[model samples]
Target chain A: MTFPMGLAGPISGLVCGVLFGYVLQRGGLGNGCRLTAQLRLQDWTVFNVMFTAILVSAGGLYVLELAGVMHAADIFIPTTFLWATLLGGVLIGVGMAIGGYCPGTSVVGAAAGRIDGIVFFAGLIIGVVAFAGIYTPITPLLGAAAGPQAQTLGDLLGLPAWAVLAILTGVAAGVWWFTRRSAASPAITCAD
Target chain B: MMKQRPIWNSHAAGAVLGLVLLLTFVLTGHGLGASGAPTAIAAAAANVVAPAATQANDYLGWMVEGGRNPLNSWITWEVIGVALGALAAAWWSGHLRVRLEGPPRANNSGRLALALAGGILSGFGARVSAGCTSGLGLSGSATLATAGFVFLIGFFGAGVLTGLLTRRMWK
Candidate 1:
């Protein structure tokens, strides 16, 4: 069910974007060292931030849905694209390792005045165009595999999405606790 | 310019970001996104030059999902906001300055070269994967999507492996 949003929609979006960006910068996520540290598993800052955000969003959305105030947007639902998800995921991972900035945080990095972020942004645009140019040629391999399976964990398990969400919530909380606890300790894990 | 202030605690930062996402969903009916703008720019460029090819390629054709103007999407506007927001945060925190992020031993040219390479790979990857850490990891997983979980697994696994292989770049 779509909520009744007029100017509230875009206004809230901008406000939320500002809030999110502010937090990311303050968290040092826009810094490449922090980004690479997470990859090395030497710093759980990225993990802590990401999982916690997921938990909050998931929990909030669940409540809103129950109240009939919110529903999933059609555009945000990632189509099945089994092969693309798998292959694309691997590539994104490698790129994150190499760049230390994903599409979102790269914006933060650029704002923080990192030359790397700007270069990466330019490359990202070029890459998008490159993909578009070659997309037709790989249709059989990439496009044909696209299907709208909905790709939710709930669908795969024959369970309600809320159940999987509950499990995920638990996992996020557990991880958040573990990271905090370990960060407090000097010798628990190589990563703090 | 003032010296950089220390950053916020990770947990606090993360939780606030979550609330922001929740607000976004409630208001706009969509979570935040980062890659749509670049993709749209690609489409706009194609339309300007090779209008025919824009429709020819199945993948390229998606630039106009729902027959809406790709360049004028809400997400695109939000990304512009992202830049401004980041700039505000950085300026306030004294983090806004031109600097290259890399290992100490690297020269400017080398740092730039690496950044470009990494950017190209990441840019291509985001397009191929259809989302990045935010779109797939945060937003998708929040909704209990399998693809997001799969993406997280793949993203982290590859990140670790690649980081190990290229440790010298940042160390």
Candidate 2:
């Protein structure tokens, strides 16, 4: 039997967004402090959740594709633009630290009744407007880094997808183990 | 009399999120996103306010092509669902409160201004990168996309550096 059995696209997106949003809100990840804490090396919760989610989904998707249960090519893989991605990411990250919310968490934070989230969202709108105004000038840099290549980790590393997945999963497991052990200490626990 | 947890356990919450992502892929041949919703809305607004200018801009033009309503996109509706879901979660956990959050030293006005500035930066960045954390970093990385991984690194690295530099903002 097919999984996700006959659900329409919009309905599926709705259900998925709801579930994803709920998890983010409930996990205290909707808070900017908790997320930033990961960077401070104080709290491992964010790292734990993020890596785990990535590993699980990555592994799951691979397995499903291998089993012929899912068509991997149908997935919406974003194109690569080395310069644009790096520049945009750095800016977004800095904004997250300053504002205490990324685009996604900011949305959730606003929903959770944080006034700051609303303000942050307003800034996001303005930022988009500014970008649009200057789009002509930046278009070349933004869209011209490299080939809009659809390469994967395996392709870059010259390894099989499964191999890369296994390595990533191992790394995640190691981080989890270390973080858990460190968290058990009274001092470290307080830091978190 | 009782201390309430912030929300749910991270692992449990993450597992649910993973399952949802998996389900999304299975059904829609795609994944969840957040920032694109607003971009589309903003594009539509530009189209209405300044159709000529919107048409002149390559990015906005792409969004307005086919005479499709930007608000009619999947990302827009899903973002609505996100707000609703977060509200539900917050309400259930009794964490729904209205207040400005900032470092004790910063005034509400300043905090609000900074928040707005940060949001603007993030929104622009999302547009430049073609996705935010969820769409690019999470979804893209999950699929092992090279651009996604690069974005992830840049995003997190810049975040840490900025967070440390602006530690006073949240203190």
Score each candidate by Cα lDDT.
0.74, 0.78
lDDT for each residue of candidate 2 in A1-192, tens digit (9 for 90 to 100): 544354544666577778887888887777765766665555677767777787778888988888887766677777788888888898888788777788888888888778988888878878888888988788889977674467888888899989998898888788888788543334322111
lDDT of 1 by residue, B1-171 (tens): 966787777778878888887777666656777887678777877777787777666777766545556777676777777888888888888778888775445787776776677777777777777887877877777776787887888888888888777776655
- Measured by DockQ, the strongest candidate is 2
List TM-scores for all candidates, in order. Answer: 0.87, 0.91
Strongest candidate by TM-score:
2
TM-score of 1: 0.87
DockQ of each: 0.57, 0.64
TM-score of chain A of each: 0.81, 0.86
Residue A28, model 1: lDDT of 78
lDDT of 1 by residue, A1-192 (tens): 466243334556567667767778887788877787667665778888888788788778778778876665532556657777777778777777777688888888988889888887777787888887777666665654665566677777888867887787788778767766544444312111
Report the Cα interface RMSD of each model, rounded to 1 decimal. 2.6, 2.2
Residue lDDT tens for model 2, B48-136:
99988887787778778778787777787788888888888877777777777754567988878778878988999998888888898
Task: Give the lowest summed-lDDT range of ten residues in model 2 chain B.
Answer: B1-10
